[model samples]
Target: MTTTAGSRLRALLADGELITAPGVFDGLSAALVARTGFKAGYLTGAGVAVAGYGLPDIGLLTQTEMTERARVVVEALGDVPLIADADTGYGAPMNVVRTLRAYEKAGVAAIQLEDQAFPKKCGHLPDKELISADEFTVKLTAALDARTDPDLLVIARTDARAPLGIDEAIDRANHYAEVGADVIFVEAPENLDEIERIARSVQAPLLINMVQGGLTPDTAPDKLAALGYRIAIHPGALLAPYVLHGLDALGRLGGTMPDVTAGPQGLFELVGLREWSAVGERYRDNTKDGA
Candidate 1:
């Protein structure tokens, strides 16, 4: 049997090199990330809310919406492992069981659950509310127990830095790790000092969120690796540029069409037109032969 993406991610994590995952909201982004030879892709909640649904990342997406999108993105990603965001596990601790199964069934290699209250805002955003650490621990435990595959990572994220303090966020991160979370994420640490402190303080493999124009500084990959960080997810790297360029393209559409280089064929090629055409040809001959 082929090694599952979860198994692959476990191996990658064991290798001790920093795993960098670019955020992918849709199949196109997932395919592009895979094509670019990334180790993994993050199904970013923010990206999905903004790019997929034209909504903000204020916890508006449903479990079904995220899972349905995960299935498409996982298929498009092929062998690449996907680390998906399951905001608050979609509800209470018991709700996490169904959410965990749904995401696992969708073939994501990892599921990230945060400690924010229902209707959670983006980590970088202010006015975020968090459930008690003990409450989140129960949710994390539920997800961990509900996981069918041991290799499927359960990442625990704490959005307490902005609301509580860096010390509280670090404490929550360690507590989650102790409660069977495979990875620990301390979200939106504002400075290099907090970033270093998180790496030093957390007792498990650490994951950091690297958001441009957000609270965290853009730490270099080498520096992060040096700091003993395991995973770095840049959630808006693609979506930000895509949105900006899309706006520019929309503005240009009212005038003469800009010089078109990659027309339909080239764009289709990026999405495996040739491979699909070959499959069509093979089936067409069988259909014509009535076999």
Candidate 2:
């Protein structure tokens, strides 16, 4: 049988230097990322909540919504692997099982589940709490069991660094690895020292989130590879640009604004406004022949 996208991701985990994936928020973003020749892409919770629902990443998006988005992103990328964020597994152990199966059917390469308490907020946000480590282990095991294909990478993320401490986060990561997580993500590590500690501690491949202006500084991919990190997802890198562009466009559209001229006569020109007309023109001959 041909290897599925999930299996391919698992194989990539075992290979060389850290896999660098840019965060993709929509179909257009995913397509653009694939065109950039990156090996993988990440579906960030913050990006999804903000772009899909125009809401904060405060447990507002449902499982169906996220899974549907994953399906769309997977289709858009074609063969490019996708690592999706499944926040707190959307509920309990059973919920984790369902979430896993849904993403699997959607053809996601990997799915990351965090150990945050229910109604979780963004990792960089405050007032975070964690479930009992043992309970989370059960959920991780359930996620592992639910996967029909071993190639489906199950990434366990710990949000305990800020609330519990670095030691606790490392401990939790180790425990999750024991429970069969393919990769360990110690989210929001405070500094280089902590990142080094995580790189040394976790037995499974380590995945790090590098968000600009967030808890972790933006480190170069080569440096992360030198520290033994396996994969690094810059979930907010592309998003920051989109946010800034939108803000600037809104500002320009306000009072005393200068008109911005359109640039280039390529894909943007045709797809921006003339997409339907272009499609009609392409099929116009067929329709005329039928008539």
Give lDDT: candidate 2, residue 5: 91
Name model 1 segments beyond 4 Å from true: 254-291
Best by lDDT: 1
lDDT of 2 at 253: 82
RMSD of each: 13.8, 13.5
Tens-digit lDDT string for candidate 1 (1-291) = 888779999999999999999999998999999999999999999888777876667677899999999999999999999999999999987899999999999999999999999877778766788999999988999999998888899999999999999989988888998888999999999899999999899999999999877778899999999999999999888977785577578878874433332322322233344555566569869999996
Evaluated at residue 245, the lDDT of candidate 1 is 79
Off by over 4 Å in 2: 255-291
Using all chains and alpha carbons, the TM-scores for the candidates as numbered come to 0.86, 0.86
lDDT, candidate 2, 159-261, per-residue tens: 9999999999999999999888989999999888888888988887899999776778778888899998989998877877776576578788883433322
